[model samples]
Target chain A: MNLGGRHAVSTLNDIIEIPIDAEGDIVRARGTGRDICRTLGFAEINQVKVATAISELARNIHQYAGKGRITLKVLGAPRPGIEIVANDEGPGISDTKLVLSGTYRSRTGMGKGLLGARRLMDYFELVSAPGKGTHVTLRKFVR
Target chain B: MAAIANFEPAATRLARFAALRRALSQAESVDAIAEHTLAFVQTALGVRSAALYASTREDEDFALIASAGDADLPPSLDRTSPFIVELGASKGDLSKTRELGSMWGVDRAIPAWQGDNLVGVLFVTGELELEIVDELQFELERALTVSIVAMLREEELAVLAIQERELVGLLREVQERDALMRADLEKARDFQRQMLGAVPRVAGAEVAVTFEPLELVGGDLYAVAALDGLLRVFVADATGHGVRACLTTMFIKSEYEIVRSSAAAPSSLLAQLNDAIAKKYQSAEMLFSAVCADIDLATGATRLAFAGHPPACVVRAGAAAMIGGGGPLMGLRPRMRFELVELHLDTDDGLYLFTDGFVEARATSGEQFGDDRARDAIEAAHRAHADVGAALKSASEAFVGGAKASDDATVVSVRRVSPEEQAPPSLAPASAR
Candidate 1:
């Protein structure tokens, strides 16, 4: 849970690691993410859902933050869940609480993308500071 | 017995009390009253010196009000000092005294109170019997209690009055600036309306345009330029709403006009326009989506070029198909290439072009009136023999019901009028398809 730097955040079991710097990278991340979801035995519908969630996060990085990293992880053994962690070193969000509650939207970015990603995932956690950075974690069960 | 003899007389004491009350009541302000109180105490008690110190607004420290000759007042009087503590606890008592060297020295401290609130301390230094000192304390306490309370009240009101005047001035300034901005926006809106151009009534085509800009002003533009017996249509919408976006549309209209003579083909025209925008506004953060199409009047042949805009619906022969466009948004990069899609338009076929606001418009349930719905609307409008712009608008309004539009909506419908409708069958030119 406490992944300090960019390298430590992604586990060795990460299915795919994408460096999103342009709009095309989002499309690439979405395609590769659905494949990983399919390999984890997620149903077709769930794979599309997981892929769509990855697309929004990746696109947000390309649009507002300019560049960031997205790591797709599939956990095993005791439990199985697809996790996506997006880290950005751009201008960080100051009010994570308001953003999560769906009350505030950034001037440049639409209010729907983050909330839409949260809706697709079974678990959502966000850690951010004004000038430091933003780290988002999303997970969906393999049902 | 010695203290009793120092007292002036019962009548004189009564007269002095009444005079003190009269002088305080007539005082105009806090500082004026403090000045009067200090002067009265020195002359009535015949003291060598006197001073008055009171708490400031924050009650953190006491500020000296008025002082006369060798008063020996402290530079700062903290509210937490023991002298202030005793004054607050006992309410009004002059029994307390601190030893500082004095000239005519029976130095006494008196507390001034207003309805149980301790306002300040009064200090007097003089040579007097205990009885005269007690009498003087009673008179000074009575005088200052009335004056200090009135002084604090008047001082508070004075500060508030000054702040109110300043606030009113600031509000007026803001209102004036807002009026000027609104006037500028109105003028800009009028200029943009002129750029939409009159409804085109060419010999072989029927063109109708619908434009609705949000009060905040969004960039939605349509230009119909005729060249070499061909009609060139250009439509563009900029990102975000407001004055900045509206200005971009002006630039697009002017650039389209300037390049008309140099660029003959649809693709070349779009490419030239993109280069002009990208070069001039490289740092403006203004991006736009546009589509350019030239329709030959004689052959009904059309060539379309696009720049990151929505697909245009080609409705012909009772079926509808969307022509997809692929290119980067204009103003983002220099030398961007737009691919030209060539299509043969049959007589009476309609080409519907619109901004994303039409499809992205949300219904009451938060569902977007999507591309499929737009395609369906266009097909229905083509069948109904009604205005395509009106049909699409009514359909979207019905879909959204009463929901407010989040962005400005625009539509341009160009239907190649059949040759039979223009004139008598024999009079129709051989060049008409």
Candidate 2:
């Protein structure tokens, strides 16, 4: 998305893009997201939630897809907020519903991984197809 | 009128001057008072050299003490011509002008006195007119004594002050070192507390742990953690006491947290712990002795593993027996396998774990309290009280009574929950629990 312009720039809403790999490149992207939220005077509790959400999504990409990329940008003006987009071309989810279900579990038996990330953050969405891979996005606002 | 009857005023004055000069020459020793007298005579009479001599009466020798001369005699000038004649002269005797060059080199002699005895003499060996010498002798004697005494006192005080400063500096260094040691000890003590874990609250068990440190920092450690449907407990004693031992325990606890999530079996947990500890403490002389157990609240089944530790006692049905056969101590060897012993617990059965401080306590006669005595005390407490917490406390107190625990004393008690207590809705499913 073209979240660029003088008006967008003056609004103090910046865009940051990062490519992920096994070397943990997305950690830098997550840290940038937290810094952007903090600079916009977001609450510490909200900023931490956004940072953690970004980290979890980024880690999920590295773990499931082997490698991916993420984009974190501040959106809207006057009432500034954050948007995180993480996409990976890994083996597509065979059962998206089951993966998102609370009953589904990882080897650690921590079934609440995706559900927990959604609960802690303000906005969450997930889209995936069997052969096409997955796209996940999260949003948090300064207010 | 002068020719007929003349009284010479100049002659009378001259006589008095001669007598005073003679007295200076006969005076003995060159102490502060005598040194002052020589200085005064030199300044007032304008004599070039004035020296005071101290005499050895037994040897009839005189040694120079204070001198202002062309070449001062080395502090010992004895039985020479000038000194010998000067000593022979009695009080009030004076030597007339005599130039013996370097052999005697005396221009004049003045007697020095000590009470009525002729102690020594003062010699003036420079050109001075007789008139001025006669006039200045008395004033010189008075000033010399005062100056020498003051200079001597000043020298003594300077030496004393230097000594005092050195002592104060040494004391300050010791105090600074002591404060640093105390701060380090406090940090170690806080770390030890963190390693022991927060006091555990088991759903079906009453757990009471008391740690009595011999000092600010101690070597003993005990912890209880409820993780993954199992209650894990451990009590460890590191070799020696204080900072080094405390650090060993902390290292073990950190390693424990990492392994504890996956290892549900006691022997497996101990094996992992031993391998990690052996690698970390290979260079250290100290090692860890511990008993680790996993108790399932739902099944009342406990698996215990020991590594050269004092065995824990299980009190059930009015009888007590030690749990777990001992194994090699941790950190001693690599790849050492720990033996695991499993036991089924009846409701309300109690388990007691303690360090060697209890049984190893010595009496006045230097005999150990012994394991048998310790077992008897536990039995007595169990007979007196049904509650496991009370029994353990009473037993330890009675066993160590009046004798101080030479090492760190620690106690951990666990009691199995009855079926009724497990019936609560909050309890997890039997499989999960």
Candidate 3:
């Protein structure tokens, strides 16, 4: 559901809103995503992958942005997959190109979360610039 | 109905009062008192109804307790009313009351007292009268008053016993819950200790590490990588306490391993560690202070970096010099740059990579075992050529004077083993596990 003038993929009832502010909210965000994925007939392995991706994105927004939200939309008909979006007003990635090119892994110890999330899902789109904010949209088709 | 005249015979009046006492002697409750008093009033003075009013507690005013006969008597006695004020002023003398009982449709009321406090009152509707029997009337009131006080004392004791039982039950519940929680914590502490793995033996150096968590589980962690020719030491202190902080350490340990062997520089390893936490928990306010030092065995070159962590030291000839490479904390952001401290140590020198918990330990006099004292303790050990871990730990304990540790402390000593001091190749690194 579109809370504002943003893209409206599903109605209010079909969208699950998880606001990530504290540590516990990150778990809740992924748990909700996993449950929805399972109900949509996702395979057990896919369920785990989806859940891990949700955790990565939610944790990203929570730790770096300080505040953000994750919305999961259950796609229907032509495409049956869960569409997840993470939105935040924190310091956005200045080099979006480098982040996806696998070089942004000057990270904790290994793979950058964005790169990992990108590989897990079928469709991934990231939009951002310095000082503006980061918006990530991801979808993995059941087919 | 039987009536006693104003000038009834003294013997007759005395006999009636004695009989009333005998009737109420077996009464146990307020209801029994009402029943016996009403019967006595009906047979002796021919009253139509009688009701008993009593205060439910010591602080309460009189309220309806029991009633018998015609039952049209006053329901209760309000302590604040003028009628009660005058009745209280009359003390136990019913003769001094000027018909105040008429306010609530009662002909006469008898006050029951336990010392100065009014425990109960007996109101009669139709008391046709014995005018003044003096001592006999006073004797009748005292008989009822004694029974009322005894009933109240028994009720209070019953309530106290019930409350005590409930208190015991709640205490047991709390103790059981505490025991379960402690068991779970013990399991977590054991898992954390197991995950620490081994204190690796570097091909060119001697390594000794001592770790102590303040609680059953803590955030301090250390992992030694001596798999390849290069020896990398990673130590991290997550920014919290207990299980949550321990979980952070676990995450860091796993992520650090993923990139530890392949990292180009010690600074790059820390950067990758930062990216792992920053990208994963970027939305959370989670952070950790860490120090990573990688030493080249062939060249004796060391690259050490600190991220919101305390500085490490280089020991040369019984002296220590502090080296700081302060940088931003890990997590809560992405792509953070960490500064590096480059140093070199040969066969005669060593290095100490430790957490702030050691220096921040406090004594009974509120004195801190600060940087200066820490360096002094390390130098003292170096001069004597004693075991660094044992000497430093004992020095800290002595300075703390038995005070509890406020945080987790980890000290790792790395020194080159001279060609003469190197252990035999048959003495494997697996033994350190």
Candidate 4:
């Protein structure tokens, strides 16, 4: 499993809309994430990777981003995986490269959550503009 | 001088009587006895034919046993013979000309007696000899008495032997079937036990689970996995109880294994599961309710999804709150999507997941233990810092108070742990984490 976040492709087989509301709402998103991974035939270890990555991604939305919508869709053809996209209009990260590189840490919380999520997936991407908010796209393959 | 001259004839008559007695004693059954009696009567009386009538039981009417000259005797002596009337009035013996004899001329009706009881009657009916003296008739009656008694005894023993054989055969068949059923149940129970194994190791959470089935095989199932730093737990309960329910659990377990790889995406996983089950068991009434949750230990972020299952409870600082999402029950429909709820867990916070069997468990008075009771148990466990599994068990057991549980009960407690409580960073395996 690769945790690198990347940009989303236009291919889709199935799509799901999950709203991240209260702190507890992240649980449902992660559950749906695991269900998709399991259906894709990910091993037990890979399933955990997918679920943990989803939890971290969704948690980022709920915590730093206030509340956001997590859009899950299936990718087919070139690669088969469940693509997880968490976008928020919360205060955007000022240093996207530094945060992704794991060198930057926010005073309020450990900076490892996003980095940890990146390490858990096959592909990861982060798009953010200061004041505009942050959008993250993650993909993990069944193979 | 005249007495001595008749002595030779008397000895010859005595010899004949001995031969008749020997033949009657050696007869094996009623039919054999009948044949022997007819032959002896015919030879000694110098008659062309003789018939014997017998009663197998005292309450039954007499029927013809054997005939030498004719097979025309009526099935029952009472129907055509006045001999029964004459014999009934006199138990000793009777010889009379027939008032109304059928074709055979009536000669004598002599009672076949064993002690004072009459077992049968011998009828001598033919045209030839009217010359039988009183002494000759007395001898004939005594021989008839011995033969008739032997015949009845043999018939009774034969019937009893046949009845006993049939009864033993029936009992053996029942016992064999019972043994086969017992073996089959034991094998199924063993297979179910093997399907449930060790709990998954999650990074930042401590998971404790308790499962109790009402029967050797039950419908309760649970799965725990810590993959890529995320903790996922699932618990499900199929409908009904006992062996049928137990079999249904296997389907749930296998389907979950395939879909659990979806990891954090429980909605699609459940939808796929529903499709699989609906297709496989189209005609069956079997279905399951489930709750699936994924937790990110690092951030204490958790997402929960349910399919016709009870909501999970999150307990923090001794306070319990309900969290649930709704959807159609799994296996009921294809391509169904479930609602998802997201939650964050703080240190020392725990999520309590269970099947309805836990809340719906009944007390001796038939009162259900309900959701409130379950919350109370979790809260008590949180306050006491006790094992949640034990606390839930104790509370339900107390309420039940010796009443048997009507359904299988399962509980899964996933508690977020402090940094110190977690495994050392290096010791935390990198692959699964």
Best by TM-score: 3
Rank order (by TM-score, best first) = 3, 1, 4, 2
User: Candidate 4: deviation at residue B347, Å?
Assistant: 2.2
Any runs in candidate 2 off by more than 4 Å, and if so which? A1-143, B1-32, B35-50, B53-104, B107-121, B124-165, B279-281, B284-286, B382-405, B417-433
- Lowest summed lDDT across 10 adjacent residues in model 4 chain B is found at B424-433
* TM-score, one value per model: 0.53, 0.50, 0.58, 0.50
lDDT of 4 by residue, A50-103 (tens): 877777777778888889988888777787888889889999888764455333
Candidate with the larger lDDT of 1 and 2: 1
> CAPRI band of model 4?
incorrect
User: Per-residue lDDT tens digits of candidate 2, residues B35-60?
Assistant: 55555556444567777665423233
Cα displacement (angstroms), candidate 1, residue B177, comes to 2.0
Give the per-residue lDDT of model 3 (tens digit) for B134-240.
Answer: 34245445655565455444434333443354368569989999999999999998898889876765678878777877888888999887755678888899887
DockQ of 2: 0.00
Candidate 1 per-residue lDDT over residues B177-264, each given as its tens digit: 9999999888877677766657656778777787877664668878876777798888888887678788877778788788877888
- Candidate 4 per-residue lDDT over residues B57-140, each given as its tens digit: 444467677777764566566623455655555654333433323334655555655565555666666542323334434544
Mark the regions of model 3 whose C-alpha exceeds 4 Å error after superposition. A1-143, B1-153, B383-385, B423-433
Once superposed on the true structure, which residue ranges of model 1 sit more than 4 Å away at CA?
A1-143, B1-149, B215-217, B261-264, B275-286, B334-336, B362-366, B394-406, B419-433
Isolated chain B TM-score per model: 0.66, 0.63, 0.73, 0.64
